[model samples]
Target: MTAENVALVIGASGGIGAAVARRLLDDNRYSTVFCVSRAATPPSALAATPGLRWLPCSGSPEDIAAVRGELGDDVGRLARVVICSGILHAGDKGPEKSLEQLDPAWMQAVFHANSITPMLWLQALAKGLGRKQHCVIAALSARVGSIGDNRLGGWYSYRASKAALNMLLQTAAVELARRAPASKLIAFHPGTTDTALSRPFQGNVAAGKLFSPDFVAGRLLAVMDAATADGTLSYLDWDGQAITW
Candidate 1:
């Protein structure tokens, strides 16, 4: 790994995102690990980590652009960018179980968090990521996003948002293939991790399937390391298995 390479983790206030940032810092691969999240500061556990920089972001266009500007020339040197921004539930609004529960506002919010936000960040980082050095860019996606694998047919907003995210990444991969041939894009599903995002749904997860934040972070890093810069968007699981699109 190049000593000058840097990494960025968006939504680093979350469990998986924080863990990924910590792992990257521990690996000693990146010279700096930028953690962007809605929170102004990191969790107490991560605040003391060296080589870690916390940047507050609200996922807005202005905020995202400002964060990129904060990178300055380091933008071109970014080796890894992991976008963990997504919303499964908010307050009393949870994943819908049926068509009757669908709400336009909720759907809009989910789409913004799961799809548009990532695409916005991708747009902002396109030039910097279009360099010759090998780079791996990953976005946190869910298995429920797969159109072909949908059997239960619930959580309409969440599912559709993630599916839209996959499409955005797929389309972006095609363009980046020409502009950034040395870069690889990945849509990663970390499964049902034991985080606040999954806390309410953990009861239904099968045994041996739910994972810890640290375990998922390690596996994600391993999967990304094994990925080749083929200019294709890989929708993969924690174990590096490709999921049906």
Candidate 2:
């Protein structure tokens, strides 16, 4: 949209989220940025930005209400919303695992963190997105989430949860097309970034395969900027290559 637009970034305490905020701020395009995270303490960088607002929320209805109270109703009708909230449990990785070794608790944790949390955010904020013009809602998803690309089969819980997230975003896109015809909803795959989430799994990645958070953030911004509210939900890699459903 322009330097005058407002952007809301969820999970702003983390690497990718923080990087995206920085990129948005540096461009001088976004007039204000809302950085939301569950962390009790705000990040130093986010807190230091002049037009940036660090919001603390537990992703509950009550917490979201509190955030809205602090930021006011006008902030809800933002031009762009980026969701970077996600988690991968310790045991959710690895190529081979037997049913006996899988922990139901771990699976539930992964699903809650990776899939359900973002859905709640969408449900809570859908109405706030301005209905008069085009807006963008982009959520961080993963390539492993692609059911059609699961050749090597691994990371059962994480993969399954992301797949669920893709479904949710796609469905949301369809509904938004009718209700808020100007808003585009998308599911994004940031590829193998050099962040805490991907550090343990980078051994097999090529030298340039693991991207910096800033790089991924920039590419994501580019993708979102190019997207139209045509009910075409995308699952794409860092290079903007579309991943199969």
Candidate 3:
């Protein structure tokens, strides 16, 4: 929250990601807000925002490194990093309702986007996060990822991918404790937000539960503000409540 600190949001072209980027820039706590996305064009809402630097990245190792190179000294000043890259459905592919609907190709694609992509960004940012400055790294996870709390069993690939993401963050937190003691990692579940990601599935979400992107963004930043760098991965929801893993 320091005036001189910087914040970075990957997958900045998406609904929640764009919201977070806009919120950060509006807060004016950070001197610069760097938004990275695979999209060829920046989100129109953020295109004109001052103190916002949009970086085009493919979420590959090389692209991430190139972004770091582009940032130069700003990487060290990063106080918050949010990875919002994830996939639930695309084109003909949708969440599996049953075992019979599962397809290996679709599953693999979901896993790559939801699990591997975020980890790659985490790996690339690890060194930069090691600086003495306090930093919080948060990735968009889901309540469905919680094995202990799961009562409904469906969405096979999406659920598994988020679960894998949680595990990866947990393991990374342990290593980061030794290397970047000042940083904290978070796995966040944003609930049923009113976004394109949930549009096709919102028919079942109870009234008053479908949050707007702005509300989720505010809640997430508040959670980060109150969080401590305890060298653990906190799985939290939009309300700042802990999620069982």
Report the alpha-carbon TM-score of model 2 versus the true structure: 0.92
lDDT of 1 by residue, 1-245 (tens): 67888998998989999999989999777989999999988997688888998999888899989988998878788888899888999999989999999999999999999999999989988887645868889999999999999999999999999999999999999999999899999999998999999999999889999899999999999998998889789999999999999
What local distance difference test score does each model get?
0.92, 0.81, 0.90
Error of 1 at 88 (Å): 0.5
Runs with alpha carbons beyond 4 Å of true place in candidate 2: 2-4, 90-96
- Cα deviation of 177, candidate 1, in Å: 0.6
Q: For residues 1-245, what per-residue lDDT tens digits would candidate 2 score against the true structure?
A: 55667888999988899998888776666788888999876667666777787787998778877776676664545777899988874554532255665677788878887898888878777766656657788999998999999988767888899999999889888888777888888789998888888777689998877899999999999998888778768787777788999
Ranking by TM-score: 1, 3, 2
lDDT of 3 by residue, 1-245 (tens): 56999999999999999999999999878989999998876789888788988899987788888988898777788899999888899998899889999899999999999999999888887776644768889999999999998789999999999999999999999999899888899999999998889999999989899999989998998899888989899999998999989
Worst 10 residues of 3 by lDDT: 124-133
- Order of all candidates by lDDT, from best down to worst? 1, 3, 2
Residue pairs of candidate 2 with colliding backbone atoms: 3-29
RMSD of 3: 1.1
